[model samples]
Target: MSLSTVQQVLARIYTDSKLRDDFLTNPDVVGISFGLNCQEIQQLSKLSRQQVDLFARSLKRKRLGEIRKLLPLTNQALGKEFNPLFFQYSETYLPTGNKKHLLDAIAFTKFLLQQLTTDNTQPVSVLDVLRYEAVRLKMFEGKRLLFCNRFYYHLETLINSLHSDSPLIPYPQPNIGIWFRLPNSQWRSLFIPFSVKRKKIFSFHRLVQKYLAIQ
Candidate 1:
């Protein structure tokens, strides 16, 4: 096989835990499956499994760091649960291409949402924050221009509490936020309390225009 083929196999082994385990357990079989010749298989098998494992762990840590940077608010909100959850995500899905980090963040966000939905134990505020950050990430990637969501708690308060490392008390306070990217490529958000009792007819266009004028 070509040297590039060997490199591809090695890359997969490093990034994929299950494949690494299989290779370590049965190197020749795995090598042959990847079209590695006998000599190449022997060379691969000669490498220390412990070193390979350490390198794999280091790669995972690096990926985790990149993902954390991309989803800072989600990472902060999830706290201790974040790393383990991300590690789990990385095991199943390995992102590729120039936008790999962004893809990883987007995929991990969806994974988190599914997990939260299944567990149903994490505070609803977490879901709200996760979604908001996901939207921000999508906006950054130019995948979205406008986004809107209704949050059960005050969005700014929740974000501030996470940043300040203060206690999170999710008192019910419904609010709606509109996020959009400006013509200059700057992102902005507008928040209005859902409980705001308006005497006049509500016009979303007027509301957005009024907020934009104030800004």
Candidate 2:
């Protein structure tokens, strides 16, 4: 079999529990079904179950780790419900194509939005925060900011929506940018709104670009 086929089979084994269970129970049959020849099947069957299980578990752990980093507030807001929700959400919506964690977050945000629409339930503000961060992370497209100078010029309008009397805004909507990239190259997030001068928004952005030597 081709290397791509092997990768696909291994990937399925890692992601699909039912298929992994079947493979663990009898690798020979699963391997044959995956188009592996007798030698390949035998070699695969020789691999112990524990190794396969560990690999599968590691993938889940890594995914959750990424989710925790990308959606820290959302994870904390859900509390004990986060893990179970991730279990159900991940099974139903297996992310593909992009290995970037931000892409996974974008997918999760979509899932949350759809779930809310389908259930017609109260909106969760954490999802809004997650969407905002995801967009911020996806800001650059081919070395140019996606929104360019537009967002810097419109901080007031964006902040206004967060504080609107309408129920559309997330509860406990913060008045400040909740997440910021610190100088040490770490993600620093604050739940409380911090004071920001609208006039400084554009100037500060320019100053950061010039002094920090990064964007």
Candidate 3:
């Protein structure tokens, strides 16, 4: 995906006021960069090569939400500004990176599953469960890196739609659906050289560059 394409897709996504607002309020939908190899991407996302192949083959003809299980995820962290624009860019530009796409789909599916299976539903608060799970999963260790308020809101909308009078499909949950990256010593050690705030900023851009480079 070219820089222009990334910019265009992001522009298209954020051009809608609702999506933009949703993006700002939700963090789990946030996209982060990953430089993982093919095997690693597959393993992290818990998808077989053939499944990814099938997903890629169907992407062109299927609705974006339909291919929900094939988005890739970043085990790394992202800054305050990052959100669904990462997804918008991937879907628009790197649609063939089925592993990355699967990660997003899995995260989304997990969220939907949580909504349907949570202990409480009177108020229909999937966001609460999502926040708790995200914390339990250590999506953000010291502070939030990805996973934002906008991500939760949009996810709530998706789950509600799936459970509406005219349903889309039954909820799904895979115990190993969530994706995470193994840390590299070189990358980890590099952070020690920077001040706290600088390290956070550095980590954000370096990760974003990984995705941008592929584009």
Candidate 4:
């Protein structure tokens, strides 16, 4: 009876729903596949299915909570679709590493983008919003000073619509959205039109100062 192997199987059974179901259905077979002997299999088989399911649900809720904190705007925008989509994502993927939450967020953002791309049911603005949030996550994780990405719709208008539950009628106002961290470690985000060229001698410091003054 390898304690480490049994622990590994238990971890998967707790986190992976399909494996949990299979184990509950045929514990001996599943245990054998995991290199568990007869005694270990019998011991694991004694675990109550209802209790295992409750623990798994709790784990999923924790993961969902972390994702909501990391991507509040995206979660708010998705509304009813968020939970189901995350459930689908969790079925196939389990993030690992020191920055597992961050990794999970980045992977989920890409998954959402792929899902929306294939379905074509969601507004195009949603795709941009997901990308914007993903960039923010990466920026904060890396402590990057600046990150920029192109957005097809007016970001401010889209964000406002999401907040208000108004119709998402964002026009095709393309621009570069910029996210920067201040010296005090506060983050700020804004957009600039593509028309703003380097040759125009725009003062970023002045812009930041003015934005701070207004705030």
Descending-lDDT candidate ranking: 1, 4, 2, 3
lDDT of 3 by residue, 6-101 (tens): 444344333333443443444224222223334433333443435534544354335344332222111111112123433343343332244544
Which lDDT tens digits does candidate 1 get at residues 1-215? 88888988888999998899999999989998988999999988987889999989998999999998988888888889999898888888888889989988998999999998898968998898898888877887886677877777877788888788787656667777788775777777787776645423436687679787998
Q: Which 10 consecutive residues of model 2 have the lowest summed lDDT?
A: 144-153
Error of 1 at 105 (Å): 1.8
Q: Candidate 2 residues 13-64, lDDT tens each?
A: 8878888889989888899888899877777777677898888788887888
The deviation in Å at residue 125 for candidate 4 is 1.4
Output the lDDT of residue 23, model 1: 96
Runs off by more than 4 Å, candidate 1:
182-184, 195-210, 213-215
Cα distance off (Å), candidate 3, residue 158: 24
Residue clash pairs of candidate 2:
none
Number of clashing pairs per prediction, in order: 0, 0, 23, 0
Candidates in order have lDDT scores of 0.84, 0.59, 0.35, 0.83
Worst 10 contiguous positions by lDDT, candidate 4: 194-203
lDDT of 3 at 2: 47
Model 2: residue 2 alpha-carbon error in angstroms: 3.5
Q: What range of 10 consecutive residues in model 3 has the weakest lDDT sum?
A: 72-81
